[model samples]
Target: MIRAALVWLMLAAPLAAQVTEPDGFRMDHYRDPVPETVAGGATISPEGAYQLWQDGAAFIDVLPHAPKPANLPKGTIWRDKPRHSIPGALWLPNVGYGALAEVTADYFRRGLTNATDADPSRPVVFFCLNDCWMSWNAAKRAADWGYSAVYWFPEGTDGWTFMDYPTEQVRPMAPQPSQ
Candidate 1:
């Protein structure tokens, strides 16, 4: 009985931490173990994403940006953290939030349009970081928006750079005021 109980405890430990995909966007705990499958899109590995990149699939990075703290003392200069992503990738910061503002939604739509040149049929890859749900949410949103070919890279830049792939510094897209 003791040996059986130990084995059961060990097995249950992993399941305790596993997070299942929800029917809708993940509302909290942005950094957590994501579900293996994204309902409406394909979950891609680094190698597969690299191949698609070479074939002209657009990559969108959804890592949120840190806005400068308004409480900073006068004369304090704030510098944004530099983000390095796969080459030719567009960094669409903050669009991966569980819920989006109207402006943010418009920004996302505009970014997708810009990436695909207004073609919904073009393949687009979304990613943020390893174990991040933001990319998963964005990928589902794309598929829901009628994008025919949407790919989600769960491992993101960390996985890409782990394989010694090249990376380039990228800036977030600035949505126009009209958007």
Candidate 2:
């Protein structure tokens, strides 16, 4: 009985942290929320986002700012850097706000502050692993904060990598430790 109970507890432990409320449940835990531009909510599509990139719209890739490992498991990708980024996209990792529940007023402020610090008027595009909530949450948060134009690239890096586009490997700022 003791051993069985221990096993059950172990199995349940990991799941305890995985519960998430649906979108916009709280200021910090929302998923994909409506865009501010449309009176009613608007959904940004991948093709539409791709067109914006091709047309050289002002946008930034908010992946590098991720404070944790990318959701894309290693080995799933052949070469990680995009073969080519959307013509004029800038790289901005998600920093730490990777989920709606993880967000705080400070987190939103920091994201906007960091983004604006680079280019105040630039419309920002956020992304992560394809179909993940991190970028969606980030973009929605940005829009909620009154950013005029916030675009989300749902296809993420995998889409760019699969397309055989140009990409460059950016060395991390810190020195890699010897294996």
Candidate 3:
């Protein structure tokens, strides 16, 4: 435990200097180190998220699904990668992009409503992968959308799995238009 704390302290300073909270959504490099804090929302760790999950907080997974390339040969077999996330988490693909199309924006708004069962006061947790900015963007968007309780799990599935937390296959809240 002491060794782990030492290592983290050594790495945290250099990394802390490099990532600044963005004024707006991160427009690119979705997979990168993220800032430690997000405005208008709370940052949570795996244990905290687990406690909330136990309490039935709404969890939203904003990891985008990779689609098969249109340029692939007609007969080439393409298999979609599977996503396993925190149990009961709503999988809303592509909503984590820095910018949103009208359709995607609508979907996100509606998904939140549906996921929370129209309870605007329900605590919602947003997450993607470890060191990913997508979750940060989503959490901010949720807060801006007036979600009364919003939490950002920056470590996401990577952290969850690291804790040996149970996970299950999750599909999109609904069919998502390719972003």
Candidate 4:
């Protein structure tokens, strides 16, 4: 009986680890919501994104900004670094996420208005890292805000890079003050 119990524990331990292991650096977590039907606009593929880009779509990157490191040496000089994005994509960080907090919504609205010159008919595409919800939410919000043509690129920057699509360096937008 003692031998059987030991064997069972050994087997269960590995299984438990596998079940509880964190999904590390993978684009598979949080299944793509609204895969078949976007709330307001259509979900697009990498190829479609490229086509829209060629047609002059306004690509928006909705990836959240990584917090800046703190505790640097007082004299440490930080230079402006180039961040990469789909060519011509406006880096509107922090606008994506399933929940449209008032602050985030305002940022999205302002970004759209500023980037597209308040033209609702302008073609717009929203994306982030693959499988992230930020792009999904942002695209929906644009459509809800009366944008006539909105596209959600489900295959995000990863997919774009994988396809060898052109990327350009961009600076992220500053956080807007909360209402």
Clashing pairs in 3: none
Backbone clash total for model 4 is 2
Give the RMSD in angstroms, all C-alphas superposed, for model 4.
9.5
Off by over 4 Å in 2: 1-21, 25-46, 64-88, 96-122, 170-179
CA deviation > 4 Å runs, candidate 3: 1-18, 176-179
The candidate with the higher TM-score, 1 or 2, is: 1
Highest lDDT: which candidate? 1
lDDT of 4 by residue, 93-124 (tens): 87766566797778778889877888999989
Measured against the true structure, the TM-scores of the candidates, in listed sequence, are 0.88, 0.48, 0.87, 0.71
Candidate No. with top TM-score: 1
Model 1: per-residue lDDT, tens digit, 66-88? Answer: 98898999999999999999999
Question: Ten consecutive residues with minimal summed lDDT in candidate 4?
Answer: 17-26
lDDT of 2 by residue, 51-75 (tens): 6666655544545432344676866
Off by over 4 Å in 1: 1-18
List residue ranges in candidate 4 displaced over 4 A.
1-34, 69-82, 175-179
Residues 1-179 of candidate 3: C-alpha lDDT, one tens digit per residue: 99999999998877765688999999999998899888889999999999999999999999998867999988899987889999999999999999999988999998999889998789999999998888999999988888889999999999999999999998777664577
Ranking by lDDT: 1, 3, 4, 2
Model 1 C-alpha lDDT versus the unseen true structure: 0.92
